[model samples]
Target: MADREALINQLAASMGAGGYAQTKYEESRYDPDTGTLYCNGQIITRNTIDLAEGFYKNMQAKCDLKTPEGRQMAAIYQVGIEGISRLRRAEK
Candidate 1:
């Protein structure tokens, strides 16, 4: 198994660069009252972590790594999705 604490820290760092942590914690706030994480101005009540992982998998499936540009973009997307996973694990 992966070291979840480390992954969470890493994700927090990545998201913090763009003020995502501020937005999630201060502005959006996870509502224990509703058991939801407020994100992008929406109430994300369920499977936020799964959704993040699934999004990366879906993108990987769609991307064609036959070209240099495609490979580069896919790599970037992979990193982005990994950040999401870190965040989700941290939240849990």
Candidate 2:
């Protein structure tokens, strides 16, 4: 509920302030207040949950999920997805 949304907002703010991105040498940002994601200073998405899920999925796709590193990330991604899903369901 509220806790989940707060956690997601914190994550988004951290990502934006740190300029995090999936790929190398690319800059990306997320503004939780506006639910906006920006990359290279351009608006890419307005849904922070989907943006985070997509980022993790893209990472999972690029790496081998069978490996320890990939598996670790996949597990984290699943938790994130679950959090997002819960929020969505609560909204409905």
Candidate 3:
């Protein structure tokens, strides 16, 4: 697998001359007085994309959510992205 620790640097250096880079840290709260846990760092960008039409609008790509070629993109956004992935194992 690609080195995750180098994601931020690799992405940052691959941008154009005026491209901007921002590091995002996702946190989940359990309760007001209880506690919480931090997921990890993710890359957030103010970029736009054209889905169907030829028009472009400002949108958050959430690149970390998309997976390609066995890349661990989701892990990057695990901070705020949470879902019950079989919290309990199935019975035999």
Candidate 4:
């Protein structure tokens, strides 16, 4: 993996990276420590996993209701998850 990354970096450098060290574009993922998800230079999801049942229950019990923004995000993620799960079931 290290060699692969080094070779990619070298190749990219040879071709003028244009600020990309590895891939031509970059993507980010959810960071547990920050409780957020960043992708393509913008934050697409925040407090993402808290929408799950257990975590949501815990937050509700603690009276940690979210603001309007969080609620909207939660609804979106819930719908997306349901859709994906349904598709997986159909595939099986």
What's the distance in Å from true for residue 79, model 3?
28
What are the C-alpha RMSDs, in order, of all predicted structures? 14.1, 13.8, 16.8, 11.0
Candidate 2, after superposition: displacement of residue 41 in Å? 23
Top TM-score prediction, candidate number: 1
Candidate 2 segments exceeding 4 Å error: 1-46
Instruction: Say which prediction, candidate 1 or candidate 3, comes out ahead on lDDT.
Output: 1
Summarize candidate 3's per-residue lDDT along 1-92 as a digit string, tens digits.
44764675566557631212222333522211211112233322212111211121111233433457223543433322222112111111
Backbone atom clashes (below 3 Å) for every candidate: 0, 0, 0, 0
What tens digits encode model 4's per-residue C-alpha lDDT throughout 1-92? 98998787777557643234523256654443444444464443333433454454544444423777667666655566664345334433
TM-score of each: 0.48, 0.43, 0.17, 0.29
| Model 4 regions lying over 4 Å from their true place | 1-65
Tens-digit lDDT string for candidate 2 (48-89) = 567777886776667667799878887877777775565455
lDDT (0-100) at residue 33 of candidate 3?
22
User: What is the full ranking by TM-score, best candidate first?
Assistant: 1, 2, 4, 3
Collision pairs in model 2: none
Off by over 4 Å in 3: 1-3, 17-22, 26-92
The number of the candidate with the highest lDDT is 1
Name the runs in model 1 displaced over 4 angstroms: 1-25, 30-35
Give lDDT: candidate 3, residue 18. Answer: 20
